[model samples]
Target: MEKDRRSLILDCAKELFATRGYHSTGISDIIEKAQVARGTFYLYFDSKRAVFDVLLESAFETILSSVKPVIVGPTPDRNNILKQLRINLGRALAPLFADRHLARIVVSQAETLDEVAAARMEAFYAALRHYLEESLQEGQEKHVIRQLNTKIVATAAVGMIKGIVWTHATGSESFDYHEVVEEIVEWAAMGIVTR
Candidate 1:
């Protein structure tokens, strides 16, 4: 019950933030949207920014948990690797597609909140780029990936994903995230994977 209430508050805050922007969202607004007493909200979160921080952390966890180190065996099957990449992309995107409120906050409002929030967003992206760079370096070393600047590739890939998620979250025209995942994998295969 305690956990559920906390999650409820979080869900409501995410929706409010997505619609209102972080700067415009207030503790009262979250309290009202959550349908919880002001004191109850205080028990869970000290302020609106505190709630936003938790929401941001949760988004990071959801996306990062979907990505894993691609294990390349001595004889790695290219097809299997590509399949895994597709799976990872789908996993990372599924929740975002399901919850556009959270996605909008993550892709759009997160950095604009404040300097601390901006730094947190920056660190999150840096961590993602680091992971991607490391994976690409491993693939190159194992001859699964062609020679390229891993840093630039990682940066571009992260930027592309952010853009796609932003579009999917906020665009007026609807599109399938599954197809987007496949498109991302195919694009990567064409550009990064060795034949």
Candidate 2:
């Protein structure tokens, strides 16, 4: 019951945030939408930022889980895998783009907030970088990618992907998201393929 109520509160808050923006979505709005007492909210989260933190955490976890299988399981050559990579990546990252409130909150507070949000963002980015580095390292060992600095490349790749995500989310559809992702995958693997 407790877990369900907490999840319900989260779901309600996410909806409110998506619809009304984070700054405007008060605890009262959240509780009303959740159909739970105001006091119940305090049991789960201390502040609005805390709720945002939970949402961000879930988004990261979803993205990580979505990408993990494609990276960890045995896969084919880079050329053959680009499509799968793009698809998996699109699905993984598309959520962060789709959830306007979560995306806006994380991106906006990334540099503006004091210790808590800063630390949370830093940890999440570090974990993402670490995952990308490991994936690149394995691809390097398999001769599926270039012998470049995996850390830099991975970080840059993630940054590029995030940029693309932001662009697609905020800008008009100048190009398809799949096209953008495939382009990134292609460029990333081009110089690495051996004869």
Candidate 3:
């Protein structure tokens, strides 16, 4: 099927990009890894950069889509809010933890591609910051979160998660996702919730 072939090409390209690095990867390498003819590859992607673009977009979609807005009910239980935070984080982290290749590509190789790629990554982070800032503002209005600079807090939170992912992707030792998620939730709860 056409869809299957396209997915095959994408999977192979993701593997190659993560292992070989974007600049080092070429169309020939991707086609060879994909076991597809030159023309077949062209049918799906115009170039290696095109393939990289699709992969990057896919990664962004997965993470951003995972973040469901934390719902504050009338009761507004602290435990419930923390539970929602844990759920959101776990969902967001699941794909990356499951696929080291994807994690490496998104965290390490995304910004290295070119100016366009760097800008795309920046935009992705900006979207994340905006979402966090909005959520923090809502929490403050609901009296669930303390008063603080939402912009700075959002930026710092995004940076912390990025740094954690970068370390996990690039480090030799593997981490347990559940533990990481719990630690992050605890740290966030301590910093975010009103006493």
Report every candidate's CA lDDT: 0.89, 0.71, 0.90
Worst lDDT window (10 residues) for model 1?
Answer: 168-177
Mind sharing the TM-score for model 2? Answer: 0.74
Ranking by TM-score: 1, 3, 2
> TM-scores across all candidates?
0.96, 0.74, 0.96
Clashes of each: 0, 0, 0
Q: Higher lDDT: candidate 1 or 3?
A: 3
Query: After superposing candidate 3, which stretches have Cα over 4 Å from the reference?
Result: none
TM-score-superior candidate, 1 or 2: 1
lDDT (10s digit) by residue, model 3, range 10-99: 999899888889888889998888888999999988988889889889989999999999999887888889999999999998988888
Please, what are the lDDT tens digits per residue for candidate 1 over residues 150-186? 9999999999988888887886657687889889999
Residue 3's lDDT within candidate 3 is 93
